[model samples]
Target: MADARAANERRVRRLEQMKTNGSAGAASGTLKAFWHGGRKPAHIVVRSALLKRVEGGNILTRLVLPRGVALRFYLLALFEAQCRLAVGGQWENVLPLSGPGSWSDMIASDGAYDGKSGTYMRGTRGGRAAEDLRLRQVQGALRTLEEVGGERPDQALVEVPRGPRGQRLYPSFRLLQESGRGSHQSPDIYTVPTDHWHPSRTVTIPAAFFLNGWVQVLSPSEVATWLALRVLSKWAPEKHQESGVFLYGDARKQQFGLRRDAWEDGCQRLLNFGLIRFARPMKDGDPAVPPTPNSWLMDFDQPEPRERYEPHRYQVIDEGLDQDAVRVCHRELTLRQHALDRRAAEVQSRKNGGPQQDVWPQWDGGEREMRFEEV
Candidate 1:
């Protein structure tokens, strides 16, 4: 523990020194480096086909996700873990897809919805009104499994080691391992590495965003669009935390095979959710030259203003119908982002030999020793 803390301190100091002296990785007055201790990255590994169906404007509504944040978190975690398990392994045959995650980290059920799966009420996590919300989330996940692996009912996704007594738990899926090489291939050729980088394409997102109940209410397409934007965010300004830093042009869209209508809907969903802010919708007149992708600014973690919000056309799942169901997503995101801001400030302050309010800001596992176990 001491060594780890010391290493973190050194890393902190090195980053501070770099930015202060305008050395490598220095940006305007801030550093664009990953903090020593910060947001817990939910490593996600997605296949190209899934995103195409979800984000690239698939017409089928069969695999549409349930608007529950908890289930979404489970899916993201499972997908990420499964990707890690795929590499260097038997990805060629009927692959058993699963990922290991603690209940607390994934669901945040706090033992409220432990044993009761079907008989559970709307008050599953929050209140009486939330009962249906939670149920639909479970349904969405089950349907997703059916969409992927329906031929064999026994092989369908299901939770293991059922929850204790009355406690409820989330549903899991078991899809027929995706298409790979021939069945005759030697077993030695396929083994998934536990590490993240082994997968050719993977992106790390803050766990809070997916787990936050606000994001859970979005349609699956909207979620994919948000994720697509995140992928596009890599091209944004690396040094600053501000949004509207990157552009998403026609070439990139063409390469990804993302249709304009799909792209518009995705961005519109994000805008309505207040996740991203567009200064202006795309301007008219232009088939020859691709317009600069500067109209939209990323607002995932940026602070939202208190003034009257712009006229938003998108509506929440239970908008105007339920009372407690409308947990202001923008407010939740703003708070999470605020916590992140404090973290960045602490890093800068500590480097300057000043005191830090909370030494560990986002999520802390610095004290936990590294261990490897079979999933």
Candidate 2:
């Protein structure tokens, strides 16, 4: 159905799956990422529909993730779990809530557990405690998805609202029955997007910083922005990781549906945490008005390290001709504005939770008539 769904996801997964499960000829197909440096880091399948929902502007209405990184991290664990289940072809293994069966009894993931019946719940988090903490946020997201899918919640949609420890619960993703052969089938199945498996759509995310405590406090948007950067990194890992790049193309903002302020704030956070630095692309051989990008590069590991990436160095040339140049000019202007906003955010963050600055001087000039400040 629609080749399993979602354009970007279909190709990447298909190629990788083909390489892993293909015939002798297909098995010989070598991917640079798979063979380069060392064996490629294993990936968790993230459904294209779901990724679009998280990052797409229109697909997901009534934004469910209101606060910070909880939603992002929850999705991380959920999708990882889905990837394993799909790969193993062990769909619908979660124990039903019938007599003599419980969540602890099912085989959840690739590993073995003592008290837990299955590897499913724990597999979602890859058996890491820090990653597992994010799973607590999954329940609310599930509720939101039910609304999006146009499904009304019936008693069968979920089980006990809370676990034994009073933690909000989510239905085990193991419920997706690909065969549809169970005595009682769930109307909703874990979605496996129709995969043409575009090889180019594959993204490689290194489990380094987050695993090592580098980005524990990121917000949801920050997480999304970081991921977008990670996707970009796939194009040139050495350049992206070494230089820490920017969203240089003017149209990429609209293409990715990123709100200006959110992206800038996310960049600032990454910079402050010593993970990245920003600067303008080196302008060299050019036609006078050399096209350059005001961008950020990773500041932490490199031949030369620096404390901050220089900003506000862009000087727009209004004399340029042609429509394309005009668009580039506008993007620079927008980036200039972003610099100012980021500085403002840094000052506000120091004050804790963006406190309003009392710039009215308490009694500016003839304030008896009216005050410009919030009352």
Candidate 3:
């Protein structure tokens, strides 16, 4: 049976490869049309096989995709990680249905309660507070994951805060679970709003599509490079263009936290990434300029480039390069244009107001004919 399944899978893979080639050819045709006319073709061509299986989402549900994918990947990834870290079966699975459903039992067993379970629910003695607190944290993480993922998630595990009068609150996340697990025993991928499911349909997403969507994976090398970029970006070419020494000196002083060795390491990482290029290297036996205090070049003319070592600047990398960077750059350009326009208008106004201040009234209007007194 396994051999038969494997053969079928191989056959499917071969057919999919052919389909991809056809799609590429069609895409090339579309691009050619766009290049010629600057518009997409009125009719888009799709393989019959693809057309047969596309189940489009509803407008509201479709809108959810952006958040959905982000939350799903990040939260699920984090949850999986935490689960792996946690002692197996030591921490109970508390369904988020009730604020403290299973956790309440965990707390109630701790003898942290007084009257019946109902009494603790009504009164606050800080009883079972830990359970409630964990729930709160999970709730916060869930909300963050949802926004980041750009999708409404399975809310079956969620419950909102208590009402003003203390009634059970409605769930912010609505759960959508389907019956039965797949062959791998995974929970068959629950989603919010039930319309997204269909059997025998292949689904795929681009690798790195969530590049800046979730947690920024920071490596030591990457962190170092970011620090370097931050410091280098702030360099005032106008101020230090003449000496270049002041630039390195200031960087060394201001970036006290990152030592000389660390800075050099960071710079090495940045160089590897190709984000910057060296302007010039000091040659042996050449007279060197003394570095200026508190300048970007305080330690330049060194054997190697050094890291920028500025924390404030490294935040540029922490945020990650994404649509946000593009938007910010665009906004800055727009503002700069506005400022330029305003300055131009002011200059035009001055020009129109008669520039007689700089000229001596045109040599008193009539003293132009100097014919050497007819001599």
Candidate 4:
């Protein structure tokens, strides 16, 4: 136990040294350059087919649409249909889907009025009409799934939970899994309620899939991130960090080579995604320190600011160059341009007979004799 404690202390000390030294090899060089230069780069924007139409519909509604439709347009249609069925002519009671804050407050509940299979909807134009319309939509969606996938369900009516505050009104359906897939390959569909559109309603179709012999429902963001990363993995940056940086310079002279810079780049990418935050260094000598390099121990599972996911927000620093070199070049250019501008301004002022401010005043550096009496 003592040996283990000593080893842990050594590791903590090493991390502190790396955090202070600011070496190029401290972490991944690619990530170091990215962090030092600027946090914004361009590659991180998510472009799932559903995300493309965020302005026209809420994220939940778009989840129900076919893969290619615009997210926003689908949402608008969903909301309109809900209004027509739930409370025709009562527009004031319906809500409007707006921002991320609204999305977070949404809930899904199973109400007594939750409909069953084969319920045809009828309504005029407001919240009640909207409720019935959404129910029909849910059934329609289920039927379409049958037509496309050709998987028949064992049951006629599956009761799905109503959305937050009583918005959703759809019966769910299930399709049998094909050969070679997991036992629960067929997932039951359910409607997710949201407060985005307010009193009227918006419902989402969610699928519960299996992983590791356990059933799990993937959120929209989770699914998008998985697919996006898969797409991005093919185009990973040319350079990555080597493992040696974590070992400190003790291994620098060793024959084995490690590209520690790559790890830093990964860190920067994660930071750009808002998955991790860079903590301001605390000078106090606390023995129980956090991991300094890569810092993978952070609470990365939490929701990050959506903007960080854009890959383009991180600047790519060429592995061969130093950040100081770029800053020097920029300063030199600015000085030269300022001198030229000053000269041009003086010339322009002379030509136009405009009020001019003298950039340089006459100067006499030599000592002068006391000859004021003669003058």
Please give the CA lDDT of all the candidate structures.
Answer: 0.35, 0.34, 0.29, 0.26
Instruction: Give candidate 3 misplaced runs (Cα > 4 Å).
Output: 1-225, 238-256, 281-375
For candidate 4, report its TM-score: 0.19
Q: Per-residue alpha-carbon lDDT of model 3 for 278-314, expressed as tens digits?
A: 4344334433433343332333365654343312112
* Native-referenced Cα lDDT, model 4: 0.26
TM-score for all models, in order of appearance? 0.37, 0.40, 0.21, 0.19
Off by over 4 Å in 4: 1-125, 148-172, 175-375
lDDT agreement of model 1 with the native: 0.35
lDDT of 3 at 247: 24
The TM-score ranking, best first, is 2, 1, 3, 4
lDDT by residue (tens digit), candidate 2, 44-142: 343333323222232222232543232433333333334334443434434332112222111111122323552223444333432232233334444
User: Per-residue lDDT for 6-66 in model 4, tens only?
Assistant: 4333323323332333321211332223323442221221212222222222222223332
Candidate with best lDDT: 1
Candidate 1's clash total is 21
Candidate 1, residue 239: how far the Cα is off, in Å: 11
Give the per-residue Cα lDDT of candidate 1 at 362. 45
Rank by lDDT (best first): 1, 2, 3, 4
- At residue 188, what lDDT does model 2 achieve? 44
Q: After superposing candidate 1 on the true structure, give the runs of residues whose Cα lies further than 4 Å from its correct spot.
A: 1-49, 52-62, 65-76, 79-140, 148-200, 235-262, 279-326, 330-375
